[model samples]
Target: MGIGQSGSKFAISDLGFVSGGSKRRDLGLNQLILAEIGPIKGDIRRPVSCALIRLLQDPDVAVRLASCRSLCFLIGDCNVSEEDFNEFLPTCWSACFRLMEELQEFDSKVQILNLISVSMEHAGEKIVPFAKHLTDFFQKMWEESTGESLLQIQLLAALRNFVGSLGYQSPICYDMVLPILQKGIDINNPDELNLLEDSVLLWEATLAHAPSLVPQLLDFFPYLVAIMERSFDHLQVAISIIEDYIIFAGAEFLNRHASSLAKLLDGIIGNVSDKGLLSTLPIIDVLVQVLKF
Candidate 1:
């Protein structure tokens, strides 16, 4: 029996499977800890956590995933300190990045990403203190995993949540995002066929939650014109983006992109279906009202 400061008992025999166990046993132990050892006080909990963290590098992919899920719950509910949790982040981050590289199953990879998200949710604003580390990890993950569309999409969605959580501190990572955002929005790119839609959504997410539009972001306005020209596949999303630009960048946006914007609006009005027109017209009114045209 493993004993803790509060006289809590964790059966050591159960955790012995952690060192030489089948995937199923490892999975069982993880759930066992959360159910049984959740209130385990004192240093007794650390060895169980270490077992799970080491299992993160296990040969069995199932074990790795189960181990990660357990760690998230342990630090979230077990008597773990924020300082220890912060120290644990590097191990967790590296394990996740390695798993992302190794795991072929789509669902497994998503579980890994969502596990990070769950950690963020449990930690709440406490995560803000590690923005630099989090963004560094995000940049590396993106750089190391190019051309993997599903991974790219999942990571962007996760990163968008991070941006929203980071709130005012989000733009610290904009330098990493700018190129991806630019590449995703370029309708001419062959890969954009898969990435464009999510990329547009990410753009809107960034714009909506961002504290202020940096100059590079304002420059993204013309890409919306490009998107409008190709197709109104993202009509309402595109319209909403334009409204944000007009509201935020004001006269400078109009002066910089007026002619092309006018031409794009003219084509949109001429070509958009009645349904699409319903969405496009008000933004046009806003544009005219803003410019006093």
Candidate 2:
């Protein structure tokens, strides 16, 4: 067995086709850990995909969750050839459909969170419609203040990220995300504040990846600005997201939403110290560029 960098817990040899081999069955936690550390090299795309597909079907929840997480990460790293991914897509989508159906039955918010995360991260455009349903479920769950459900919050963020990343490539998804966002912004429960905060962060993250969403931004920002004005604790995060919006979405984004964007910036700048204002100089330069153009 090939030893991994840290030690002998797992090795390159462990990732091969025969997952039930002595090492995989004996020492490994699950197919996830095995697929992660195994030495399944470049040409083994189909085999690796098949192995992950099987692992994704494992009866154990933890095993299946781990497999989903690993598969998402692996797809990013493998430099998966297009033809190979085309072959891989059907199987990947099938698992997503199955897992999404399963997630509907999940009582554990954390498991559901991880499921949403990996599904969004790996399933890409294929999972957008389901993500809409999942986000709606989260919206209802957000109302019941069952303590701070961090996983649910983060998964909502991830779902937003996935929708942003996929963009108009999935227009049906576009129609779905905004309504969920509207619901969170309108509802007021002190305990649900963090959920709202996460919702705003999700919106900002979406803006970062999908600049095209800029045109529709005014629909959301006014409510966020009002919330920031009233809340001392969440003000900084709100301002940070606006700054990120300025940077990533660029001047064109600001130009399209100019009047409203400026109003929001004024609100944010008004809350900051002089040092914060000074730090905004570069953003000013960008604004200047947009004006010149």
Candidate 3:
């Protein structure tokens, strides 16, 4: 009933946590602290929140990432019932806006991704104005295509995650995502690593929030099938990504295009080597689940 009792109960669970892994435990505790603190939106804890706010700029990437995640969670919870939404939402908006912009010049996709994820997780509705700018940023970068800039690709991936992770769907995000989906089908140039990843994320976004878009995406279904024919070059990762999208698209999408998916699955099944086949087991399992729906 007390915090001590809660801590003790969690400590016993640590064995299971350790079996699951240490990182999960660390993040779980961090999230717990965040959820407990609520936001400084109503308490007039300006000094304290301001101090915590500075952590967003910490030199250590991990600390900054954690701070971003915490800030987003705090703001998104809307715990500041007594405070004006304008006051608190601005704080969430400013921090996320700066991070998304600064991430363009910096490295570390995971941090950028986390920052965006948390930002959307919280004040997504408030930040709608910036979605078009975010879309422009990604479009220019993808078009540049000078080299396989890992940082840029990862940043795009993070942006895709951020856009989709928003609590509600935004037309701005849908507009941004649709282009990436079309890009993935450009068989002549399919920047499989960059463009395809973005498309898959878009697929997930549509499945979760806008199932109506699946009909439009069916045009690209064959290209998705073609990519699976290789089934080795990041094939496992690719399959895993596609599986989520397929599931998100749901029964209607699957039912309408069952043959297309079955054909793609057929290609994947044929190419699975004894070693490679195991990686695909999850993919196959997910496809079967989608078919059932």
Strongest candidate by lDDT: 1
Q: How accurate is candidate 2 locally (lDDT)?
A: 0.57
* Per-residue alpha-carbon lDDT of candidate 3 for residues 118-220, written as tens digits (9 for 90 to 100): 5554444555656666566556545543465455456556555555644355444656566655665454563665555555555545445543444555555
Supply the TM-score for candidate 2: 0.62
* Candidate 2 residue-wise lDDT at 140: 51
lDDT of each: 0.75, 0.57, 0.53
> Which stretch of 10 consecutive residues in model 3 shows the poorest summed lDDT?
12-21
Please give the ranking of all candidate structures by lDDT, highest first, separated by commas: 1, 2, 3
* Best model number under TM-score: 1
Q: Tell me the spans in candidate 2 whose CA falls farther than 4 Å from its real position.
A: 1-39, 58-66, 69-86, 103-151, 168-171, 186-191, 209-216, 231-267, 282-293
Model 2: per-residue lDDT, tens digit, 138-204? 5555544245456556656765756664655534454556655665564365435657877766665
What candidate 1 gets wrong by more than 4 Å, as runs, is: 1-26, 29-61, 69-95, 101-107, 121-125, 281-285
